[model samples]
Target: MNEADVFTMLRDTILAVLIASGPVLALALIVGLVIAFFQALTQIQEMTLTFVPKIVAIFLGIVASLPFIYATLTGLSDRVFDLIGRGGP
Candidate 1:
């Protein structure tokens, strides 16, 4: 493929990754921020406190968002396959 095709593929790949990860990453960010706020308010500087909640929240978020993530990835994969099948530029 030429530079344009390579760039387009790269862009699509990055966008797919971002879409797939967006929900979990957003949940982690929100959970971490809330935990930080709680820690600051109570002065409980426990490392495990932050880790556990963030992990749990992110896990749940991933589980909850699995269908959406899967659909996005499937669409991207289909698009990539279509490009390849058509003898990508």
Candidate 2:
């Protein structure tokens, strides 16, 4: 592939990854921030307190967003395959 093709592929790959993971990452960030705020308000500085809720929230987010994520990945894969089939540069 040429330089432009390589860059385009790389950019597409990164974008696909971000789209796939965005929901879970965003949920984790929100949960972490909320937990941190709660901890600050209560003066309860427990490490595990942050971990469990974030994990649960992320897990729930993944479950909830599974269909959207699947569709995005499938689309990306189809496009990549189409490129390959077309002998893309």
Cα lDDT computed for each candidate against the true fold: 0.94, 0.91
lDDT of 1 by residue, 1-89 (tens): 69999899889999999989999999999999999999999999999999999999998999999999999999989999998999985
The regions of model 1 sitting more than 4 angstroms off are none
Residue 86's lDDT within candidate 2 is 91
Tens-digit lDDT track for model 2 on 19-83?
Answer: 99998998899899999999999999999999998988888899999999999889888988998
lDDT of 2: 0.91
RMSD of 1: 1.0
Model 1 TM-score, 2 decimals: 0.94
> If scored against the real structure, what TM-score would every candidate get?
0.94, 0.93
Poorly placed runs, candidate 2 (over 4 Å): none
TM-score of candidate 2 relative to the true fold: 0.93
- Report the C-alpha displacement of residue 61, candidate 2, in angstroms: 0.7
